[model samples]
Target: MARFELKLPKMGESVAEATITNWLKQVGDKIEMDEAVLEIATDKVDSEVPSEVSGILIEQLFNKDDLVQVGQTIAIIETEGGDVVVAKQEATPIAVADVAKTVETAKESVSAPANFSDSDKFFSPLVKNIAKEEGVSVAELESISGSGKDGRITKEDLLNYIKNRGNQPAVAPIAIGTAPVVATQNVAPVAQKAAPVSVNGGDEIVEMDRMRKLISGYMVASVQTSAHVQSFIEVDVTNIVKWRNKVKDAFEKREGEKLTFTPIMMEAVAKALKDFPGMNISVDGDYIIKKKNINLGMAAALPNGNLIVPVIKNADQLNLVGMAKAVNDLGNRAKAGKLKPDDTQGGTYTVTNVGTFGSVFGTPIINQPQVGILALGAIRKVPAVIETPEGDFIGIRQKMFLSHSYDHRVVDGALGGSFVKRVADYLEAFDVNRDF
Candidate 1:
């Protein structure tokens, strides 16, 4: 058998090391080529590593929860030409002559049965302590199951069983001789009272994961470094909505994907970015970096209670169909927890949709060095005035709130407001046939 060493492969451009969260195979276990062998979690993401070749796991060099560097050897596998086989040691049976002696010795070591009493029953230390505190007999616990590891009795199990039994009627008291005396009842039923519900619910304190903690730190740093400003504008999306409905069926059939409002919004944003390039800029220590490329970042919510803003490269060059496919692919991958660090890096600007949750408006935070972030709110029907050549008419129109948060250090309020207005104008004048 030839021995092969398996090392951790590089995960992403910025990722250097990862922690071994779990091992799917143990030593002496047979594994196939390309089979997942271990799971690794980095600060940015988590991924599973597959085996390079079919082999028997001869030895594991690292333990679970161990931090392993990239390209480090984690295990050694033994391959048998093409089919690997794990070596197992044979066990010898015990002689029959020694069984009787062993049983006799065990019987002598075990204590004789005591008088029928509550203390004579077998109870774990924790259960015994709880029983003593509650004045409950061990006989009362015979009907309850032990929920602890290895069928051991736990305090919770006993307490819950007692609580359940307390709801039922009490058993009849045993009578003693001539005097008609009652049997000794040590345990008393606890009062059945419901827990008081608070008017305001308590907040849950959950520890932040590595990525969330990093993001929080970066947010605080950005606020400290830049002068943040926010501006809001309401846009009439009646034309855009009508145009989308007219072309949505054909677009989906042609691209084999459903067209979302995001791609349409992205097209308008790209045009706006081209007209007002200052909003597509990033701030350095002292210099402003105006990017020629309009790489738009879509903030995707992850399943792990974190957010990753993956950038679509050169979003300005892509058509509506292309943008839709790209957004669909990225959002699907992000939701599937498959995004790498590089996928989220090098963003020029970000767009967040609070409309998915039916939000009307929200002042979004500027994503770090980037000058601005656009927040899209839900569309709603509202009364609007329409002016004709002959007369003016009151009509219902679809309206949406567009809030833009920008860095005042890099982009002034006038420029930011004008950029948002330009986007709104483009959206309001959307055409199904016109290429943005």
Candidate 2:
């Protein structure tokens, strides 16, 4: 039988390694070519790797919840079925006492793996709890490196260890009775009563995800790296709204795409960036790097409670319709958990829409290294006077406020304000036929 080694596939430019989150097939299981073999999690995104050839799963090189480097052999399959040969490697001795001593000595210097533990513990809370529950000694747990929180044990680690125990078969109990009388036993209460109030409010502890921790670090770094300043402008988008409604149907029909306000805003933002190149720039350690192309990053909110900014590369080159289509596709993909790492990189500027959540105005933080971020607020109908050559007339018009948060290190208050005003002007004087 021909045996083939399956190596980890390249996920992205910045991604060098991934944690094996799941294995769909076990050793000796038959698999088909193009069948999903495993799921891997990188820092940027999670993805599934498919089998390249149909064969019996002879052996697995890495267990689930193991950190594997890119291009490493993950599995071996025998195409021409025969006896499976599993590669046996010597196990590392676990020095539990030494590890515990190290943890105590380097508590401040040590950081737990991102997934499993806090900075303090050698084992993450999940791993420690699992070991405690499973009655697995610390020495045994120490032998297994964590897939989360700096090689700290995760729940998956415990599960995989349980799976690898060939001596026992893991199974759920089957209920059998004359009439299958299922007891609705309240082993645990569904809800708990509140504790008695104290002078000081009771404190609650919450865990932070990797993304949140990264965001927090970036925010602090941004504040330290650049001097930030914000500028605001109110614009009457009545003309643009009217124009959009008039031509949206025909435009969609012709382009086979629904027009979104983001594309319209992107077009204006692109033009403003072109006019004022300072905004389309990144701050280096001691110098400013002027980006020749405008790669706009649209901040999209994921369905499962996380924020991702997917960049539309070379946005300046795309027309309004193209911009609209790109935004729609990226936003939808992001919500569907299909964004790749490349979609999140190389952004010169970012635009965040808090208006969708009924936010009238907000001062958005600058996405680090990038000079500026624009916050678009909800549109509301407000009374205003329109000055005409013939006369002045007062009428109710739809208006919106646009706020720009810029790095004062690169762009001055005047420049930032002017850029925002230019975008406002473009939105105010938008012509559906001409702009689109």
What CA RMSD would you report for each candidate?
A: 20.8, 14.6
lDDT of 2 by residue, 171-252 (tens): 2222455332212231222247789755545776568965676567667757766687888999999878888888899889
TM-score to native of every candidate shown:
0.67, 0.68
lDDT of 1 by residue, 1-436 (tens): 7777788776654454567878999988999999989888765566678888888888889988776656678888888664433322122121133332332333233233221233323454335434443445444554355554323356556656555655644434324454322222433334489898555557665678666876786677567666788889999999888888887888788779998899999889999999999998987656788898999999888888677788998999998889999899989988997776567767898999989889998887777778899999999999989899989999999999998989887788899999999999999887756643
Candidate 1 accuracy as lDDT: 0.74
Candidate 1 wrong stretches, greater than 4 Å: 28-30, 63-67, 82-205, 434-436
Question: Candidate 1: TM-score?
Answer: 0.67
> Clashes in model 1: which pairs?
none
